[model samples]
Target: MTTVPPFQRALEAHGDAVWRYLRGMVGAGAADDCFQETFLAALRAYPRLHRESNLRAWLLTIAHRKAIDHLRRRRRDALEPLGEEIEAKPQGDGAIWSAVATLPPRQRAAVLLRYGGDLAHREIAAAIGCSEEAARRSLHEGLKRLRETL
Candidate 1:
């Protein structure tokens, strides 16, 4: 049977990638909270996992879900009548990432997983819960859109 590595090892190995992915998905404002939620949920589920295969992808899947949740909450919060909040725009690489944030959810995720997380198409398929072909298409469409946007 395949053995699972210690959770700490997985955290050490993948934390940055997951954080970057979250930042790409939800913006820096919400990325930290989403990152924490991802790892917290992963910590809860890690023991139930039977094998250690693709821990990075697994963590990314959790991160993706957390990002989605944060985005939804942000959308909901935006609809409420709260005082105007001015968030500082990110600079440098953030400019490209801001364009990335404009893509549809699946496409954004596909781009982030491929470029930011450095995950293979198959790993991205697993992370985003789609077929490999679908993942590839999403990545393609996202990149194509980005090319036009930039």
Candidate 2:
């Protein structure tokens, strides 16, 4: 067995990162609810989880699905600007991140998983339920678009 951390410890370890990921996806206004939903769902399903599971990736996978569901329910943009409204300036932080919001859904998820979730390509593939090549393509194209927008 890979000796995953207990759920409480996993929450303590991953809570902040998961919240930030949610915030990056849905904006801070709804992030708290989404965060709770993620954990609630995770807790309900935790017992049946495989012992060899990658907990953080699994949690993030749940977060990704929850975010997508949240987006579909609300029909909102996948990502909001990071801090404040970004004027269309090339060098602004908000502008850069805001660009991320403009990507198509798959690309946006790929970008957020790579940068926001700090996940590797393989992990991102696993989390997003895509093949590694598709994940790589999304990440690559997403970054290219962000750069162009910035």
Instruction: Find the candidate with the highest lDDT and give its number.
Output: 1
lDDT, each prediction: 0.83, 0.79
| Residue range 1-150, candidate 2, lDDT tens digits | 554457898799888778867766766667788999999999989878888877888889999999889878766554544334223324436665566657777888888888878899999999889899999999999999888887
- How do the residues 62-94 of candidate 1 rate in per-residue lDDT, one tens digit apiece? 898888777787788775211111124536765
| Ten contiguous residues minimizing lDDT sum, candidate 2 | 81-90
Collision count for each candidate, in order: 0, 0
Q: What stretches of model 2 exceed 4 Å from their correct place?
A: 1-4, 76-92
**lDDT of the structure predicted as candidate 1:** 0.83
TM-score to true structure, per model: 0.87, 0.80
Error of 1 at 99 (Å): 0.8
